[model samples]
Target: MASRAGLPVATAHRLTGELVSWGALQRSGQDYLIGHRIWQLGLLAPAHQGFAELAAPYMQDVLFVTQNVVNLFILDNDQVLLLERMSGTRVGAPIPARR
Candidate 1:
């Protein structure tokens, strides 16, 4: 981790310990994974709420017309995060997004 971050080993270890103590990282074996606190904080961003609200009506319209499942997602940290899902019995298979 220190080498990857371009920091001294001791400094990296110290920073990792502080982050773990602060609920920002969880030590998993020899690796660190982002903690639940980080996810909670990310979800609290205003953009999430604003985007959900802005997309809600369009999402509803599509759902009403097709009666298919709808997923509201945002790209974050190179991953897609599902923010909302509306579904009925007629849901279809997933479609991959294009770049």
Candidate 2:
């Protein structure tokens, strides 16, 4: 991982330890995964908070009318991320967004 990231092994190890202590990473068996704290912080971003507030009413309307599922998405580089998801039905599979 360090070599792939172009960092020395020792430096990567130290930085990884720091991130773990800072609640940014969590040990998962032999690997590290994003921690809940990082997710929480991401939600605190102004863009995300504003978009969520702005989309709330529309999301509710979709649920009220369709009685299916409503998902909010935003473009990130070349991919779309599911910013918010409100499900009115439980049976359908997830569909990827494009743009």
User: In TM-score terms, which candidate is top?
Assistant: 1
Model 1 TM-score, 2 decimals: 0.66
Local distance difference test, per candidate?
0.87, 0.84
Q: Which candidate is the best by lDDT?
A: 1
Q: Indicate the worst ten consecutive residues by lDDT in candidate 1.
A: 89-98
lDDT of 1 by residue, 14-99 (tens): 99999999999999998899888898898889988888999999999988767778899888788888888888557674444548
Clashing pairs in 2: none
Candidate 2, run of 10 with poorest lDDT: 90-99
Query: Can you write out model 2's per-residue Cα lDDT over 1-99, one digit (the tens) per residue?
Result: 799899999999999999999999999999998887898888878998789789989999978766668889999899776788888864364544546
